[model samples]
Every structure is written in C-alpha cells, then in structure tokens.
Target: MRQSLRSPQQHCPARRQPLPVRNRVHRAWPVAGVAALAVITAGAFTTLAGLLVGPLHREFGWSRSTIGLASSVNMVLYGLTAPFAAALMDRFGMRRVVGTALALVAFGALWTTVMTAPWQFVLAWGVLVGAGCGSMALAFAATVTQRWFVRRRGLVTGVLTAAGVFGQFAFLPLLSRVVERFAWRTAALTLVVAVTVVLPLVLLLLRDHPADVGVRAYGAGEFTARPASAPGAARRTVRALLRSARTGPFWLLAATFAICGASTNGVMWTHFTPAAHDHGMPATVASSLLAMIGVFNVVGAVASGRLTDRFDPRRLLAAYFALRGLTLLALPLLMTATAGPPMVTFVVLFGLLDVATVPPTLALCRELYGGDSAIVFGWVGAAHQLGAGIAAFAGGAARDAFGSYDPLWVGVGALCGAGALLALTVVRPSRT
Candidate 1:
C-alpha cells in the first residue's frame, strides 16, 4: 500500500517542526506536466488519424469504412483500458504503469510502420495503440488530482484535459505537412520518437503519491492513509463496475458521455477533414482549422474548470451539450468548397465547446462516486469511448453507403440534443 503524506499542521502540537516553505509548494503542478505528457503522447496519434485516412485510402485501396474499423477498435480498447489502468496504478505505481503504457504506444507505432494488411492495422493501432492511449486517458488526470492535491483539483483537471487539445492543435498542422511530404511510415516513426521522448521524464519526475516526498497534498491540513487495494484488483474492478451499473446516476452520466464521445472523437476527430474534403477543402486546410479549434479549446476547457469549481456542474453540462448540439446542427449548412466566414464561425464556437464537457463531467463523478470516483469515472470513460467506437465505424459506413456525411452529422446533432436533456436529469447526492 502507498503511504500517506502528513501536513506539518496535522502533526502533534508539541512534536511539530516547521515545514520548509518550498516543501509546501504544491508538487501537483509538476505532476500535472507528467500527466499532460502522457495525454499529449497519446493524442499525437489521435490528431493525425484524420490526415492519414485519405492517404491510406488512396495507397492501400482500403475503403474509408475499412480504415475506420481500425479507429473503432482503437476507440473501443482505449475506453476499456482505463478502469483497469486505474486499478493497476493503485496496485503498482504511477511510474510503472505510465512507463509501460508509453512503451506500448511506441511499440504500437513501430508495428504500424510495417503493416501489410487491415488486420495488422487493427492490431497495431486499434488494440495496441488504443490500449496504450486509454491507459493514460482522463483517468490519469483524475488520479493526479485525487492523489496529489486537495485544492485546485478542478483547475488542474481542466488543464490536464486540455492537454489533448494542445497536442492536437500544436501537432496537427505540422503533421499534415509531414504526411503531404513523406510516406505514412514516416508519420508512424514520428509517433514512436515522440512517445519515447516522454518516457524518461515520467520515470524520473513522477511519484505515485505525495508521501514519497514526505509532504502532504497542498492545502491539506492532516494526513490521510492511502486505502489498501483489494487482493484481486481485476475482481475489484468488476465489483465497482457492477455497483455503479446499479445506480441511476451512473447510467445517466454514461449516456450523456457516450453522446459526448460520439460528437467529439467519433465523428469530428475521425471524419472532419474527410468531410471537409468532400466539399473541396484540402486536408491541410481542414487540419489547420482543427488546430485553430485546439487554441480555443484551451480557453473553453479552463473556463469550464473554473465554472465547475463554483457552479452547479449539471447546469454547466446541460448548457455545454445544448450549445454543442446547436453548433453541430449549424455545421451541415455552413459547409463550403473553401474556408469562409461561416466555417470560421463554426470552428470558433465549436472549439469553445470541444472538451468543455470534461471538467463538469469530472466534477459530477467526484460527487457521485465519492471514494471510488477515479475507478468509477474510468467506467464512464469506457462508455464514452464505446460511443466513439460505434460512431466512428457508423460514420464511415454512412459515408460509404450514402456518398455523403450529411446524414451522420444530422444524427449526431440530434443525439447531442438528447444528451442535453439527459445531463439535466443527473441527480446530485445531497451534501451532508
């Protein structure tokens, strides 16, 4: 079991020694960097997939739906990996779990460089990369906030979650250029190098618990013991999942998040460039637009965090879903052969709502799951990805079947409308 750090203030009055001023500085800030690195490393692959779709289709003669199946596997495994990873983090350590995940990401990328068949792509990108990325998903952010800090958790969660956007926007434009200039193998190699670069930082800088440094979480006035893990962590995961399955709140939260994942990762991230290409925009232009969206996502995600800290999370979530649905509804009408004012407006507005769902969703998890928030939230993440996986496959199939993406967009927008209503139904447990 991990040991807990005690604040100086919590020590016996007579035995207390002064805590060095620097020691009390929140260590979570640096830990957040490590967490962000993991997310960024995972996100690099996710952001680049859209650019790869058209190229893969042209070179391999694979249909868009065939390529999307790989993405579907990736999304499904990504979601399924989270809760198990959280349990492992509790049993092993952050450094071990994170390091292993990164290695898997690197290896998955390396394997993708040599793929000659669709099944190989599915195994590498879908199973391996998806599992690796899922291991470091928002659950890592949740783990960091819960274990490393007592105050400012919302703010940190927001920043860490925004790291996904940063990874996308910062890298997507450049990567689109890379794909334009080089073979897909070069792009796969780039992911290998990028994921490998963060491994050392994670190994050297990250600690599983603040107690490793002999200081309490920032603003904590007393020591709290880390809870012991169950003898069988896999069994524990099943139990927590079964218990959460029985709760009305869990189903409501999961349903909303499924819509969230379908909207963001499933349709938009996977198909946005191709969808734009359908209207005669270049892939590079679409990626740059996505990069722009990433910039605004930072602002929106951070503001959402602050709002969640002070406001009713359910209302914030409802507003976010409603606004997102409206923007998506407007998207079909705004499509033009080239970048224009309407497209620009959609990018800006949707960017602000992009990952804005994260902070409020996480806040609600804390309220709902209490002590098991991290692991329970992991299951919710799975539901989100399950939706993404289904949507990713279905969106591509729709494009193939109908020769247009319009139907997919309309269906997803309507689902978002349903999600907004569902968000309001989330019952907050009364505070004692």
Candidate 2:
C-alpha cells in the first residue's frame, strides 16, 4: 500500500484479497494456467490436423508423404516460430501476445475448410495455424516460470504441458466423429468454432504477471512486494538477447528439443491417425486410443515434473529418451489390432510417455541457461520441429514403400536411443 507502480490493468481494487483454496488454483491465473488454456487450444488444433489426415487421404488419395509434408511444414514453422514468441512475450505483456495468437489460430483453422489442394493446406494448417499455436504455447510455461514461480516450477510446467495432451485426448475423439459423419472440412471448421470460444476467456482473464493486477502471486500466499524484473530489463533490445542465445546451453537445449519434436509430433501427430486407420481401427476408436494416451501423457508428464524436482535433470532426460526409444520400437507390433487389449495397452503406455520428456527439457533449460531459458527452449524446440519435419516425411515414405510403419518405428527408436546418449553427455553448468 506504500508504493504504486504502472501495470497493465488498473481496475483491480488496491487491497486485493486471497482466493479461496478451490478458487486459488483459478486465482493463480498464473502463466501455467494460461499455458494450460493455450495447450487445450493448441492440442485441439494439432490433433484436428491429424484426425483430418485420414479422411483427407481417403478423399484425395494423396500419398502419405505428401500429406505428411503439410504437417511437416506446420511443425517446422511451429518450432521455428517458438523463439520469436518467447522474445515477443518478453518484450510485450503475455496478454497481448497470447490473445492475438489465439485469434490467429482460430482464423487459420476456419480458413482450412476451403482448401482445394496441397498449397492451400500448407497456407492454412502449416503456416498460419502452426505459427499461431507455437507462439502462445509454452508462453504460459516460460512466462509462469520467469515471473510467478521460483519453486515447484517443474510441477507447474507439468500441468501446463499436460493441457495439450488433454486437449488432444478430449478433442481428437470428438473431431474424429465429426470427420466420420460430416467431412474433413467440417472438422476443420468445427475447430474454428471451438477456438472462437476460448478467445474471450483468454482476453478477460489472462495477465502478464501478478503485479499487473496490483496483487502478489497466489500460491506463495504472501504479499511481499518486489518488482517482477529490474526497470528496463523487460524492454531490452533484441541484440542483447541474440548475444546471449549463443551460449552453450542454448545449443544443448535446442538439440534436445529437436529430438523431442522428432520423437513426438513428428511421428505421432502426423502418422498415428492414419496408421490406426490402416490397421482397421475405426476413426472413432482410433481417436479414443489417442485420448487414452493423452490421459497417460498427463500422468507421465506430471510424474516427470516431480522427478525433475528431485533428480538431476540430465539423468532424468537420459531415462526419458531411452524408455521412449523402447516404446517406439515396440509400438508397430503392439498397436496392430486397433480394437483389442493390445491397442489399449499401447495407447496407455505411449500416452504416458508421450509428452513426459517436456518438463525435464524445459526445466533443464531454466536451470542451465537462466535468463535466456525461454528463448533457449524456443531454439531447442525448433530443433525438435526440424526433426519432426524430417521424420514426418520419412515416416510417410517408409509406410508407402513397406506398407507398414514398422521400419519407421525401429528407426525412430534408434534415434531416440541416440538422443538418450546426448542427454547423458549434456554438460553441467558451472557457477555463473
């Protein structure tokens, strides 16, 4: 009450009260919370693209490689856009960046309904949609970490990371059914409508930092006064940031994230829907499988976050890559009967492992790289997308040739094992 500072919102009462425990989670309205909302939006759109893959293939008879390319471009552009998003968020308030991104995403998804060819797909789903989601995405994660939290960062991150998974889990089935009954165009348009619903939610509730509303953070449950950053720190020029990006941890984080992209979105998002269909699974059933994996992605990612808090992040990284590699190797065989117990088991196991690597990767970025963490994560995630982009094309090619995803499973698993070794050798930080 003794001091006043400029903030994004002036409407809040000077004496803000604590949120009741149940509502406290909402009160945090924290970056993690915003990230969760963005995750749902991103996941829905991402999985919507996958759900459409099967129907689009059936409608146009485009080769897998061709369809994969569209998703490839999306992932590539998505990853490529990450660092800029982080930088932009750093420069502006999270509210402007995320809300604008959501609006763009909804526009892109809606526009996809009218596409007549590959180029149209590329313009809508690949470029605009991907970039939009990528921008706001872990924005929540990065923003929350840097501002509202100093402890339990990994746990908060896990919840946010898990949001995308839940979105995929919850949205894919509904989308698949829409595709089954209406058409691929309907699915895309439906997403446009769905994303429209989240826009107001984002605009009204989201804020860049707790200070913006004349309040201290929620969970810390104490109102000690401190500026979120040093004066002028938030407005630092890009040159200062680029200079920092060249540090060692920058490359390490980007490399690990590239591996992350290759292992997850590269194969799963682009191929899984069609692969499930190819194996004789109905679209609805396949969607259920995808959702089941999302359920486990939440569980696994949360567990990884907890472990990240307790263990050496690098060791945890190694284990995640190795175990994920093993899972990839086993999947082609296990996911065979789309309607059986094996399929269920595969979904459960794979989903659990799906985004589990994320918390560790992001946690390590913050722990090792410090102030440059989000931008570092951005570059690393770009690598992840780059890998996914390559694998997206390759997975399609292997399937077209061998008439099975078996070869890709083995190859991707090997890549994951190599990634595990890389995680092992990730150098530790010395005292800065």
Question: How do the residues 286-353 of candidate 1 rate in per-residue lDDT, one tens digit apiece?
Answer: 88999989888889989999999999999998899999998998888988788899999999999999
**lDDT of each candidate versus the true structure:** 0.87, 0.76
Candidate 2, superposed: residue stretches over 4 Å from native:
1-26, 218-247
TM-score of each: 0.94, 0.88
- Model 1 weakest lDDT span, ten residues long: 1-10
Q: Report the lDDT tens digits of candidate 2 across residue range 1-432.
A: 323453423555443444354455544555456567777888788887677666777788777678878888888887777777777776666677788888888878777877778888888888998898788566457666667776677888788888877886788878888878888888777777777777777777777776676666655666645445333433343443566466665666667667777878888877777787777777687778778888888899889889888988888888888888888888878765446777677677777778888888887777676777777676677788898888888888888898987888888888888888888777777766
lDDT score, candidate 2, position 207 = 71
What is the Cα-based TM-score of model 1? 0.94
Best-fitting candidate, scored by TM-score: 1
Angstrom error of the Cα, residue 346, model 2: value is 2.5
For residue 194, model 1's alpha carbon misses the true position, in angstroms, by: 0.7
